[model samples]
Target chain A: MTSQTMRRRFAATTNDLLDTDPRVALTLADIGVGSFNGRNHPDRIINVGIREQLLIGATAGLALAGLRPIAHTYAPFLIERPFEQIKLDLSHQDLGAVLVSIGGSFDAAAEGRTHQAPGDVALMATLPDWTIHVPGHPDEVEAMLRRAATSDDRVYMRLAADTNTSPHPATGELAKIRTGTARGATAVAVGPMLDRVLAATEHLDINVLYAATVRPFDAATLREIAQAPEVILVEPYLEGTSAAEVSHALEDRPHRLLSIGVPNTEHRRYGTRRHHAAAHGLDVGGLRTRIEEFLR
Target chain B: MALTTAPPAVHEYEELGRLMSLMTGDEKHSAAATSTLDVIWALYDQVLRIDPTRLDDPARDRFLLSKGHGPMAYYAVLAAKGFIDLDTLTSFATYESPLGHHPDSNLVPGVEIASGSLGHGLPIAVGLAIGLRARGNPARVYVLLGDGELDEGSNHEAIAVAGRRHLDNLTAIVLDNQSASRGWPGGIQGRFSVEGWAARRVNGRNHEALTQALTTPHDGRPLAVVASTEAGQ
Candidate 1:
């Protein structure tokens, strides 16, 4: 597995897009400036100097001018802080832009809560017509960014420090990876949680599916693949981020869903991402125990 | 609905009063609407290089109303310039009316951005200036803001960046009715001038002053015109 982080891959892909596509523009808020500076199209790359509102506002302006703008920053600043800008400027104006953010849930655990945004996906769910992509590997970053740049859609590409050892195709569909015996239980692993989920349910008879895109949730595929009434959703962000989508898809029949992800309570302890995951019962041992209990 | 004769350009001021009177509602925002009436009229009649026929023209001047409250003046100007029907003004803020208290760009022809939330337009205008300049389009971008709207920190972010970028094609018209809870210490012009914008102060009601200020050449820097009206009602 290549050691490249998703953030680096996103920056590299964005830089390449800027070099080739005239319609592709990037707006920054004093984050990752060094990686993108001195590119072929300096005018297309704008750094708003730590102003997240302007980051989204300027990106919307570019979109209004018929250009595909990509706005980048940390998760909190990119999604949480200037959310109104995202809602009003981009959504309300009926314009489109690619919002690529770094720092998944607790990726920056050592930096404390301010640097983390566990609620990013939940907040984005409130807005309509947004394509939310949470890629599990660095290899998936380029394709997602490219698709968003070439089209006029409101996309939120979340890049995290945690990555799966292997790269799955960047299809926004739910790809069924494992087959369970007699369809005992179906577990959906989102983004970076694929590796841990695979390990946890390895010895069990649970069907597993991988998702890179959460919004516009692939309801059709889930309904087809989910042969059993029991479903377990494991996400990298807030635990129940995709619970509503799952429930809505299976509402016609009697079904049970167990959501597993980061908890809502603040741990208040600064450590590594692994530590945070373990604390939230998202580690392999914790996940295996929880899934087995639900199955029994 | 029969076709009516177009009003003469000189009577547009009185035409605006009549146009504004057509719309009546609980949220007229009369003070805010009246303060900006003269400036809006002057821009559509004299300053803006726009045509109602070519709404999608890339070279057409873009006007974004940042202060979207009490948009009767804006709707009146848009109607006076042939962007919308005069009859539509009578249905402003109605359930079926395209005209809302705050203009929606999607619903309203010729409206650029949907704004009622303060401090959003200036930042968006900055992006427009940058995108337009990069694409080599010669169209100018104008944004109308209220003095109270400046209290939103987002405007300052736009002001600072527009100045640093030297966006000559961007102009900000601030209707100052002295309504901000905390006023600018040296005045609104200083806040913009300090950041390299060509700043000016004029009586918002003075047609000659507004026309000159709006059309002034700013060379390599952006322009800011502080048009003072009477104290807010």
Candidate 2:
């Protein structure tokens, strides 16, 4: 149903992939196992019981054995806890898997600092040749996951409780969503940040670009559509996560960039996701001020 | 990329020593490398069903060196087994050399996983067994862990799951040079036995003992072999 969450959509897509593609398998660390029809393909779905390191190591092993592994868990545990396994086992070994995570940034805000992983994208960027996908809506999860599963490239598919109102095509390229005055600045909205970004830039002259996939960043499109000399990047994860990519895309030209997302500083207080966003200036009003300031 | 025919199982120790000598400098873990020499030799010579000509065969046995520190012995064995040429040993850890301080599967032929980080091999081996079973491939999986490498909590996670899964096709060989800072309580064998693995200890230098223990069937559970070597050897 359209009401399904991103986690549920990921589970459904995984089950279907396991049944349809013999080369596909799933590895879990006792997270999100209840939603899957494990009985149908019991052998392919392995639950390793809260061991994040083994979750990644086993996923690497599956890749080594010529099977495409779908590894899932909460964001911090999946990307941060067993990070060496991701670096050495998958990236270093040249193996491929789809690492799907829930609880993006402060999505588990009430759970406090322990579950939050604002630095996941920043950490992953240190590695080479990984395709990072931040699906904006639950509807985009299936196609992106399917694409990653069928290929042998290393992919990190970020799923979050925060989502946009509608789905955009799950292309790795940046899509020019709204065209503004040619002299206006360009704003790039990544994943769940899109809706807020659209609202933030409402009635402003800047162009809006939607990006579900952040890695292999749509530099070509940005170069093509960036008519203005000023650019703003609003991401769901760390602030300035794609700042370097943007700089690299427009290296020849002189331009100014404003990065707005989660601040590098930690917010120790536990509250609602909205409260966390506002604290970090990621809410619509906060984003509007930053974008306006950058334009000026 | 032509390779020599694998030398027969007999008299591998001396030949291995000769091959190991070619790799000079960067013996960062020489003692650690010496401890695994016989065990690695025995596996390539008599135990594993690997062929240099058929490196990509799906049914071929997989061996993961989780304790990838001091990989001189590993490189020598690969050369002896015809997976790599003898001259490549001289270029070990050099600039642009595929051989590094740790074994990289991408650069080296016949290496299943790139490793140097401790506590990574066994968990990956568990996944390999699970995958091989799912594909109906009869290939067995083996992983070699250093005694010190067990100190890494990641290995414990793998030891628990492989036993619980009853992955009979999986085997873990702990090359115990008594290196763990905090050794396992009641010995390393007990640590695995408690988790339902069929385990035993053997002399590290005995080729017959290693081949026997490695090939032993555990029907409903994975196997663990503690190849004990002298600490300072």
* Each candidate's DockQ: 0.81, 0.82
TM-score of chain A for each candidate?
0.97, 0.98
lDDT per residue as tens, model 1, A1-296: 23389988888888888988999999999988988844577679999999999999999999878889999989999999999999999998889999999986999999999999999999999999999999998889888988888899999999999889988898899988888865668899999999999999999888899999999899998888787899999999898999999999999988999999888887798999999999999999999999999989
- Show model 1 residue runs off by greater than 4 Å: A1-3, B1-11
State the TM-score of candidate 1 restricted to chain B. 0.94
Q: What are the interface RMSDs of all the models?
A: 0.6, 0.7
Kindly report which residue stretches of model 2 are placed more than 4 angstroms away from their true locations once superposed.
A1-3, B1-11
Against the true structure, what is each candidate's TM-score?
A: 0.97, 0.96
Model 1: colliding residue pairs: none
The sequence of per-residue lDDT tens digits that candidate 1 reaches over residues B1-233 is 11112233433667788888998993549988998898888788778777787889898889899999999989988888788999899998889999998899999998999999999999999999999988999889999999999999999999999999999999999999999998889999999999999999999998888888887678999999999999993
Give candidate 1's TM-score.
0.97
